[model samples]
Target: MRQTLLATSLLGLSAIMPAYAADYVIDTEKAHAFIDFRIQHLGYSWMSGRFNDFSGTFSYDAEKPEASKVDVDIDVTSVDTNFAERDKHLRERFLETDKFPKASFKSTSFKQQDDGSLMVTGDFTLHGVTHELSFPVQKVGEGADPWGGYRAGFVGETEFTISDYGINVDMLGPSSQVVYLTLSIEGIKQ
Candidate 1:
């Protein structure tokens, strides 16, 4: 009878071990978070640029959406347009990165659509302001790397008016209110 009780205890322990050890943390060294933002330059075209430094982490269970979570922080001062003067003005005056410093996102929930895409709802904090933002995320795919880490690709796109966030490109005079933003992220699971 004692032997049987010991066997049952061992079985329970083994079952719980897998559950307890199921967390997967993103490998930041191999991850990429990039953003492309464009503002209207004039009545004719737009001025485009991207952020150079941003970092984040994600927790995901390959099987379920409820088990997935994401947290991302972006350095606003890292704004780069490949031109020094424009970058400085944008950071110091327009964005005022000294005061705001960073932007962040934390996902609240995800829903898998019938087309194999995802509807991700989250809170985005920018320039000391917080807003509920939702966007469509598509799983570009997943694959194995030669180094043994797994690679997953996702593409997300969203647009917001700069004025909505208290950004005034109106100083540019003829620019529009909408600023388009696109995010392309590559995450490596370690």
Candidate 2:
């Protein structure tokens, strides 16, 4: 019958079409995300800090992980090192927060690895300079919430030298040249 043939054709078309990717907003209002950094302090210890203000969005397709994309913007002036004096020095001399108030990352590609993690490559802008950076990101989890909402979480870590972004690394000492950054993101489905 024509009805049966139409039904079969519709089902075939649906199977061939790509699944819709979900768009999510980073849950900053709930404080469920964080951007943290750590760097060696004079070759003896590590200094840890975090940025308090940031927002981002991401689109993820479970069926097509390679099509995922992410974009984040951070308020550079929101850096907190837990030390007022050191934080002030960092804002003024190191980061020059007044001159460059924002840093951002926009993903260019997301490649799924054999281990199920993603190798994310993107353009990272910091201190008025942009560079291509790549890092491994792992999906922590994704599911429906008790409150009738959906959420997904991911964590990624990468390191870069301060001098690469035009920041003066002399004061940080030789051992403190590189800064390690960690991004813990939890996004609510939009």
Q: Residue 73 deviation, candidate 1, in Å?
A: 0.3
Q: List TM-scores for all candidates, in order.
A: 0.81, 0.95
Cα lDDT of model 1 by residue, 65-181, tens digit: 555667778889988887899999999878889899899888998888888777787998887888888888876767787878776767778877676677665767545667677
Q: What is the per-residue lDDT of model 2 for residues 9-84, given as tens digits with 9 covering 90 to 100? A: 9999999987878999999998999999999998999999999999999999888889999999999999999999
Model number with the top TM-score: 2
Question: Which pairs clash in the backbone of model 1?
Answer: none
Candidate 2 accuracy as TM-score: 0.95
Candidate 1 versus truth, CA RMSD in Å, comes to 3.5
